[model samples]
Target: MYIPAAFRSDDPDLAWQLVEDIRFGCLISGGLGLMASHLPFMVERGDAVRLVGHVARANPQWKELEASPVLVNFLGPNTHISPSWYTTSPRAPTWNYVAVQVRGRVRVTEDRETLRRMVLDLSALMEPDGSPWEAAKLDIAYIDKLLPGIVGFAIEVDHVDVQLRLSQQNNADDQRKVRAALGAGSLRERQVAETMTRYLGRLPE
Candidate 1:
């Protein structure tokens, strides 16, 4: 992630919030070919940050991980900004966004007990309201039958790159114009615009 100072997000708490908000991530690893898997992840922070997730044991990407490090990308809201929305003279269109990338070594956990715990924790985190569903909802016998089909892994993050480009380079008038235009445009664009509004106050003049 090439983030200029104008678009850098260095706040650790904000970085973790983005990770939690965007639970789904793309896990990429390089080897014989570029391998990628889209998976839901749980962020664990203690002595270090660890990303936990699971995939089908049959996935070829899992087999190739022992040979190299893996990179996980968590993408937040992003939107296209039309040059027409800017207060200044015509400019080339660009994108405004936020994304976090984690680079780490992958370690597969084969232990069924650990995998089961990981699955339960993921479920709880995903449904924090205590809304319905339980780890025990699945028939124990049936779950045992399914457990063998999957494998769990934890990526200990050695490095993280976070980028937040929310029209920070633009003046307040231009930023407001972009936000108002995007907010009324489309669903995705509106969401990004809303995020920009929230973080816009933090940007320097």
Candidate 2:
């Protein structure tokens, strides 16, 4: 991702937070050609950052992983910033958003234990109030029947590129105006505005 200094963020914690905030991501890989899959991934951070997710057995994207590096894109709230909201005259419209790109080599797995854990962990992450669902709740026969239809993989994250374009290039006064304009828009726009507000507050003026 091409990021200007004002919009670039190298904070590892923030990058991981973005992944947690946006559970869904696009996994891009190329071998014979470019292939992408939208998936909900769980992040595991220890000695290294790893992303675990699965694709349908019918999806050909999994077969290409060994031949290509993977790029996972986690996108956060984004909204259009109208130039009309800027205090500066002759300003052009721009987008205010946050996104993180994780690049790494992928290792595919079909082991029963690994697959089972992957499913359970994914379920736990998506549920509220500390995840009530358990993999054991399902019949073993049913799980066995379903297991072969999917393939799981883990990407050992080697690089994380973060971009946070939240009106940082503008003055504080103009930033407030932009936030107000966005807040008055749709729910998603308001979300984007809130992220901008929080991020801007952390910066030194």
Candidate 3:
């Protein structure tokens, strides 16, 4: 990710929060060819950051990942900015948003025990409110039958890049205008805009 100095985010906690908030991420690997997989990820703390996830065994992306550097993209809320919404003269439209990218080496794990543990940990993270579903509640035989169909892996993060482009380059007036336009738009767009407002400290009118 090419982040300008004005839009760069250096807060590790905020970056991790974004990653947790957006569970789905794209795993990109560069090798004989560029391969990518859209998968849900779990973040674990260790000597280095640990990312765990799985993909269908049929997916070819997993085969090319051995000893290769992989990039996982965690995209947060974002909104399209219309040039017409700016207070200044017309300019090209752009996106206002926040995203984090984790670059690391990919390691595939086939151990059934490890896979089962990963699945249970992922469940807990996704349902922290103590949902009805628990790992032990499932039938062991049924769970065992399904384990072979998927491939699990962990990425030991080498570096992380976080970018928050909330119109930091724009003046107060222009940012306010953009925020207003976004907040008045669709629900999803408005939600993202509100987040930007809070993070950038743009007072609501």
Best candidate per lDDT, number?
2
Which scores greater on TM-score, model 2 or model 3? Answer: 2
Per-residue lDDT tens digits for candidate 2, residues 49-118, read 9999999999999999878788999898998888899888998888988989999999999998788778
Candidate 1 on 1-205: residue-level lDDT in tens?
8888888766777777788888999999996589899999998999998899999998988887767888999898998889999879869999988899989998888798888888778876787576777775867677667779889999988888888889889887998899899889999999899889777665444
lDDT of each: 0.85, 0.88, 0.83
**TM-score-better candidate, 1 vs 2:** 2
Give model 1 RMSD, 1 decimal. Answer: 1.8
- The number of clashing residue pairs in each candidate reads 0, 0, 0
Looking at candidate 1, the ten consecutive residues that score lowest on lDDT are 196-205
Model 3: how far residue 188 lies from native, Å:
3.0
The superposed Cα distance between candidate 2 and the true structure at residue 58, in angstroms, equals 0.2
- Residue-level error in angstroms, candidate 2, position 146: 1.4
Relative to the true structure, candidate 1 reaches a TM of: 0.92
- Candidate 3: the clashing residue pairs are none
- The top-ranked prediction according to TM-score is 2
RMSD in Å for all candidates: 1.8, 1.8, 3.2
- Runs in model 1 with CA error above 4 Å? 128-130, 202-205
